[model samples]
Target: MATSPQTRKAIADSENALRDTLWTDAADRLWAHKTSGGFVTTPKTMPYVCRILDEMSKDHPLASTYEALWSYTWANNAFLRFNKPDDVTFAAGFSGQRGRRTLLERMRRLQLLGFIETQPNGNETFGFIFLPNPHAVLFRHQAGQGTPLPDPAPKGLSTHILPASWNAFVARALDLGCKDVKLLLNPPPPAPVSAAAPAVPAALTSPKVLRRRPKAAAKA
Candidate 1:
């Protein structure tokens, strides 16, 4: 997921700089310095990357978590696959040595959100479509600001996303006696063009047709 030209270059730069500061054979020495427990001498890397995963969870609350899950099934939600320090450092957006704490906090929060589902084998995954309809949980059982389900909108607030398309979906479901329906929120309207007035052509400017003011009087 973090595989890109920018990321690859960043990794190289980080490793080279680290090698210069730590030792010319720092990479080799570090690799060989593992303990009897099969742990790296510098074992802070896992927690650091986990923190990045956490931030991703916090950012979208549910949407991003769903994206994360769906990635395994479809796309790899921009999650950095490389756990190496240099590889992670090179990855933009996801890589932030400074943002480690924030990311961890978010991942913890997302787990509590019920958005992430644990598989039989204890695999953690998320998906875009709530195949069984997560909206049911939000509308009836569990719902709030931070959970997997979307928060309830204000009273009488109907959705407008693909009006015809959604209505068709609702119609199909309604026939099966489904009482509740949830839809994606529509984006805000574009700025309104001034229909009351005609647009002025840039070529026919007031300075060309009307009187112009002379330059301001200057002090002697």
Candidate 2:
């Protein structure tokens, strides 16, 4: 339910005026020719990575977990070389041992929601996977952007992530062209180890700070 930045700038100006009046036939032998191989290179901000994986798997049970990790990251070029034989039960179509235990419980819920990173292989526990930078892990799962989830933070697991669905996923990937992309929305906040530490106020540098839970911890 995104597409709003003025209808994604009028559908990127009607797909750049239909790619400036598309012309085709360079003696066309039926198009699909990336030097005669199947294509895989992906992110022109893939519709903001499929609406941030459908608003972060709306009430997840790994709801198709971004189409089974885009069919197990089809021959990935940018890092993420998975253990490919049988390609995790053929991308979890449910084969033997219930499709390798449902693709190892959807890659351990995409590595407990930070969207992947694994290595174990002797026992084949997701034999090598990495894939971070899901727009800097959805701006560090949004709740306060200081980045601290992954430690018993999965009981009712809703790591906020709303800021108008992260500014309509950077305004539909900068109206579909996706240059800079606000440098992946937000990341560079690490340096200050201790220049005599004491000044973090301006309302706690808010990317999120609305605390008022305690109605029995909001009836947890």
Candidate 3:
């Protein structure tokens, strides 16, 4: 579809903002691992984690790197962009260990949330974990949980969405965490089938009711 100038500009602006802030520093620091100890959750913790991720992306296995990347995508969304998926990743370099965390911690959080069962593989320093809301992970990467954003272009043959298209946008976002998603916006409630459904039925119209309750109660 032909993207309008306004929509293109907005998408471009958003892309620039994300790249400059999250991707730049993250790509540079992904591989620096921390084997001596775990992550320190201090006021300065973010920088340390970012550094480790920077090195890991380039050095770790593809699976490990993707995990770290997704992790960073989630945290970045929560911390920076207010809990939305960064759809720009479709174009932004998807490689890089932009996100990683202690495996014990990851497993604990996942188990606590009842997203998965816990098991040990006997790996130290960093254990692998399962994430149930991988789709939400995408949304957390692409879109946030706050008041949804306005789509720059109206959806037609192809485009993001039109202005004030919160429902469609949210539907797209929710699809990240849900499967076979279907969203109905402002759908009218089903109309009542009968204007007046007889409490006692039509009675004489049916022999069963005429035999059960007397006609007087039926009429009343």
Candidate 4:
């Protein structure tokens, strides 16, 4: 059932009151965009992306590769680009050959899963990394080109993700040079409505619900 306006307003007011009481200092926090090291822009529903990563590889572990990429990205640029002279060495965080090999393997896995695109330079395979919107990639994976989903495909992947989130993902993908127009905009169909589901009240769903003023308040 949809939330009543009074209940929603009460919850919001309570949360605001709590914030006003608890978070008294801004300096104590390490701001993402303003911080010295900078931060990565991730999807709102990032857990879905993490679950998808887990399905791709069990040995490498989910989010490890994802976390590594975020660590390597030090810029606060909107493009979400990551580059360095010795990117392999920097990304691996080790000078040894073993570390390089492990990083390389992880990079390949990410590439295969459509998370990143590598621009090779001479001997250095992953010299440049282009991070794609993971949510967009998730949508593509679900489409599956008429083939059966891989054993690792997350359950309820499409249904669980929101349409607004999908729109953001598509926009990001396009900005980052995604050429496949059809696939990016092609979202999975909405979930089938259940016959037993309760009907939502028109007042709750209408846009002007919050704008309506009480007759006494209007008179004043």
TM-score of each: 0.24, 0.28, 0.20, 0.50
In order, the Cα lDDT scores of the candidates are 0.37, 0.60, 0.36, 0.58
TM-score of 2: 0.28
lDDT of 3 by residue, 88-195 (tens): 232223423442233333323323322233344454322233434333322332343322223541121111123334344444444332221222223468988878
In terms of lDDT, which candidate is stronger, 1 or 4?
A: 4
Q: Give candidate 3's error at residue 51 in angstroms.
A: 22
Model 2 bad stretches (over 4 Å) = 1-37, 41-43, 46-72, 75-115, 122-127, 130-136, 145-169, 173-220
In model 4, which runs have C-alpha deviations exceeding 4 angstroms?
A: 1-17, 26-32, 35-37, 74-97, 146-220
Best by lDDT: 2
lDDT of residue 43 for candidate 4 = 47
Clashing pairs in 1: 54-107, 55-103, 69-126, 71-75
**Regions more than 4 Å wrong, model 1:** 1-62, 74-93, 98-104, 119-132, 141-220
Deviation from native of the Cα of residue 111 in model 2, angstroms:
10
Candidate order by lDDT, decreasing, is: 2, 4, 1, 3
Query: Which residue pairs in candidate 4 have backbone atoms (N, alpha carbon, C) closer than 3 angstroms, thus clashing?
Result: none
Q: lDDT per residue, candidate 4, 17-80, as tens digits? A: 7776777663456364656544565544555466556545665643665656755664523122
**What's the CA error at residue 173 for candidate 4, in Å?**
16
